[model samples]
Target: MTFSVPSPDAIPRPDPSGADAEFWSALRDGELRFERCAACGTLRHPPRPVCAHCGSRATEWVTSAGSGEVWSFTVIHAPTLPAFIDQVPYGAVVVRLDEGVFVVSNLLDCPVDELTVGDRVELVPTRVDDELTLPLFRRA
Candidate 1:
């Protein structure tokens, strides 16, 4: 499945840096990655500088298979943000990656009424422009 997104100019671009730098870089290069604590091998999302399970500052970037299930989701029938006004009725989802960490991103391609818990999805690295990219999902 596939869907159209707002123009790159209309959508806000990400400012990738710090712990987020690698993740965004990987996405731009067409890969999905997560932060894993080097000391304990614990995986985490929203890439952090320190491990939550262990107080380790050392971490590694692990590429994902980009396979997951829809853990939860919601449809924005009426967007409150002006930038997304024309994109009303989009899906916001929490995808539980096969590696165990959950990622919050938009669920694309599938219709709101058809979206359901446990729905299988896969990564679709979306490039917004020369400087940015997004890790969007689509039903597999």
Candidate 2:
């Protein structure tokens, strides 16, 4: 029998200079982290060197509570990227955390029809390979 994985391209590429590098590193270590602006106390996503709100370089990292709600999503009927061909019809979601930052992640552990905006979900890591750990979500 052929061995199979749920999503072969689930792992993201590494960015050494991006603000998200620390977040990805933490996720690889089994922890979830968010960026918090020291000047405005605002939370933001896709990480940044300076706070978007106040342009402050001063920021801190906070571990996420690991729960969020689906803000938006799309069910891929076709693989837009060649790397994702094996995982077609999967759901990609924008999750709004309890702390207010939104993360782009994949929704897993259920049928595609079951996904909906505002659905509660939780973070779970999937092993794409021995070297890569990916953050995917499941119904909470």
Candidate 3:
């Protein structure tokens, strides 16, 4: 049997737009920022134009403290991207920020065995390529 692997470019990348653009811009500036609805006091991420809770268009961007708790995770046993083949078994996680927004990121700087729900974590910048900077998490 033979199988083909996916390329590294198939990996997800951030789209620079609206509030999402600010999130990526902040990462390049070495910070983590989140969006909050000015009308309903709801916090959101993956930055959208409207509040998910109250359907309000009044949204504002605020800097997060870069600290959060691991909500859930998946350890990739089979790497889909060719460049990440050697890094199989890496972790992808959903983190609940202290401010109440969940951020999706990869967990790094520690062994996968130690990863667990509720583990305290902090955001760190990861160099994806020459021009890309991604937010990764590590054990706090």
Candidate 4:
């Protein structure tokens, strides 16, 4: 099933800064990236300036396997924004990436009521525009 999302102009866009800029750039290139500490090898998301584990300032972007399980989720029945009104009843999922990090994104192509805590899923990139591509998910 194909999922519907708000157009690039219709939704808020992330303003990538510092290390976060690399994360967003990888998405535009159709790959999902996370940061790994150069010192402790701890992987993290939402990119940070320093490693949470070792407090190291050195980090590197690593490509994800893009497979995970649904750790948690919520089905939105109410429209929080006018742009999302048409997409109400969408599943917002917290995916536990195979690498042991969790990222919050949307789950697509499945009935919201049917989603389970351990459902296997894979990355599905939805190109919002030339500069932005949102990482959505579907059942593996």
Candidate 5:
């Protein structure tokens, strides 16, 4: 199949409710945030209800430095979704941010063959659509 970028309408929107509400909102405003425990100094991703490090319910959001290195990745050939059948050879990368948090994102500019573990990447807050913003990355 020929490759084509998915239309904005085809992309799913984040749920406006729940622990991820502020996380998604910050990205739309051109910022990246991670959950941190207010009761104890610990960071967590996926926006948990309580701190994994400590059983604290008090949490805060920490802004990222917008720079990181590729921790791991894989080039997907299997069709993940109907809207991405043609985009099979895309790279799915896990980036280790400067804050020591791992974030899953796709590369914005580099090809799969050129991408490698430990490659420095910089954040590019892209507005996928009027209501969706993504923290895409690129080779630095």
Candidate 6:
């Protein structure tokens, strides 16, 4: 399967704030960054200010291995936005990273029906624009 890079104007951009700003910036540099709690050694996604496990305010950004397994997924047959109309039947996967955090991203370069729950996947950073690049996944 071949995926076309979307035009910057055709795709939605992230509006990063606080920790999110740092996360987005790292992606632009071709790195996948996630939050790790200093107090409890827990990893979390969506870049929270506090750790959910230990309620620790001490957190730091860590570069991920960018490899994971597909825990769950669905093929989007309907366009949720007009910009995605040309991208229907894409696999939206919930990948569980080896570090134990999960991220929701698109699974590319494979047929949707061929994806499985335990399928190994690796990050493929795709530039959405000059300032924003997304961490997409492909079969490992």
State candidate 2's TM-score.
Answer: 0.83
Candidate 2 lDDT over 1-140, as tens digits, reads 11124454453466565676787787878778888998898888778788988999999998888899999988887746665666676778889988988888887766677779999999887667655567778889
Model 2 CA deviation exceeding 4 Å by range: 1-12
Candidate 1: tens digits of C-alpha lDDT, residues 63-83: 999999999988777736666
The collision pairs in model 4 are none
Q: Comparing 4 and 6 by TM-score, which wins?
A: 4
Off by over 4 Å in 5: 1-5
Poorest lDDT segment (10 consecutive residues) of candidate 5:
1-10
- lDDT of predicted model 1: 0.84
TM-score of 5: 0.90
Least accurate 10 contiguous residues by lDDT in model 2: 1-10
Question: How close to the true structure is residue 37 of candidate 4, measured as C-alpha lDDT?
Answer: 95
User: Model 6 over residues 1-140: C-alpha lDDT tens digits?
Assistant: 33455678878778878998998899999999998999998988888889999999999888999999999988777857776778676677899999898888887777877878999999998888788898999898
Tens digit of lDDT per residue, candidate 5, span 70-107? 99988889858876666788788899998888988888
Stretches of candidate 1 exceeding 4 Å from the true structure: 1-3
On TM-score, the stronger of 3 and 5 is: 5
Q: What number of clashing residue pairs does each candidate have, in the order they appear?
A: 0, 0, 0, 0, 0, 0
Ranking by TM-score: 4, 6, 1, 5, 2, 3
Which number leads on TM-score? 4
Residue-level lDDT of model 4, residues 1-140, one tens digit each, is: 23477877888788878888888888888899999998899998878889978899998888998999999988887857877777777778899999998998887778777878999999987789988888888899
TM-score of each: 0.91, 0.83, 0.80, 0.93, 0.90, 0.92
Model 3 quality (TM-score): 0.80
Residue 86 local lDDT, model 2:
69
Measured with C-alpha atoms, the lDDT of residue 134 in candidate 1 is 85
